[model samples]
Target: MQIRLGGLETSEVAALLAEHVEDMRRYSPPESVHTLDLDRLRTPDLTFWSLWQEDVVLGCAALRELDPTHGELKSMRTSHAHRRRRVAAALLDHVVAEARRRGYARLSLETGSPAEFAPARTMYAAYGFTPCDAFGPYVADDFSMFMTLDLADQPAR
Candidate 1:
């Protein structure tokens, strides 16, 4: 799959992000849903990427710079039809590499704590992201699960 830097203007990418927001809302309260909308994803500090094979978008993810040494993962989603095919993994690998390249010492994320998000939690764990307390603007919430990875020793791809 070829990972493009930005494709939010395309209908396919927009729909995928909308579906991601909808899915997040189904499992978490409105206030707990941290999924960024298209406009938010376009902000200056955040870089959005979509993984595509030929013309079809398989998944998408974003990396938001919180500061010089920190970053946050956002809007990670694999299209329903492409689930379980490592679409998220590919996007994740790209995001992590980008973060490391940008000199970020830490990368963190906040996902749902519901069982529906277990697969995501497991995947993050497999990538060496351990449970952590809230970071950035997030506060402690039962509906949220926080995980962080230290990138100091992470080998570059």
Candidate 2:
């Protein structure tokens, strides 16, 4: 599969973001839903990407700059048909590498702290992310699980 820079023009990407937001709503309370909408994802600070194989969209993810040395992983979603195919992991690997390329000292994310999000938590753990206190504008919330990876500590993957 190939991964490319993503914009808001494609219908498939639009649909994916719609489904992602809907799923987040279904799984979390309104106050706990942190998934970005299309407009929010288009912000200058966020760089989005789409993973594809020939013509099929496998998944999409984004990295939002929190500061010069930090980034937040956003909108991580693998298409239903692509689940268990390692699409999310591949996309994450790319994001981490990009963070390192950008000289980011850390990469962090916030995911639901429920059973529905267990797979994501496990995957992030496998990539060296560990539970951490919230950063950026985030506040303490039981429903949100924050994780971070220290880019400086990682040997080349």
Candidate 3:
């Protein structure tokens, strides 16, 4: 699969993000869903990317800069047909590599604590992200889970 930057204007990417947002709504309560819609994702602080093969998109992910030393993972979604094919893994690897390249000492994320998000939690854990208290503008919520990875502590791969 090939990963490229910025497909926000494309119909396929828009549909994928729409599906992702709708899936979030289906699992988490409205107040607890923290997904960034397409418009919000277009902000300068965030860089969106899509993994594609030829003309078809397999998945997408975003890396958002929180500050010079820290970054946040956002809008990670693997298309329904691409699930379990390592699309999320590849996207995450891209995000982490990009964060390190940008000189970020750490990367973090916020996700739901519900069963619907268990696979995501497991994926993050496999990438060395540990559960942590809230960060950025986020607050402690029983329905939310926060995780972070200390890039500085990671051995070069």
Candidate 2 lDDT over residue span 22-135, tens digit each: 888888899999988888988899999999898778899999999999999999999887899999989999999999999999999999998999999999999999999989
Candidate 2 off by > 4 Å: none
Better of 1 and 2 by TM-score: 1
The models' CA-based lDDT, in order, is 0.94, 0.91, 0.93
Query: What RMSD does model 3 have?
Result: 0.9
Q: Top lDDT: which candidate number? A: 1
Candidate 3 local Cα displacement, residue 154, angstroms = 1.2
- How do these models rank on lDDT, best leading? 1, 3, 2
The digit string of per-residue lDDT tens for model 3 on 33-82 reads: 89898899899999999999899999999999999999999999999998
Runs of candidate 1 exceeding 4 Å displacement: none
Q: What TM-score would you give candidate 1 relative to the actual structure? A: 0.97
Candidate 3 segments exceeding 4 Å error: none
Better of 1 and 2 by lDDT: 1
> TM-scores of all models?
0.97, 0.97, 0.97
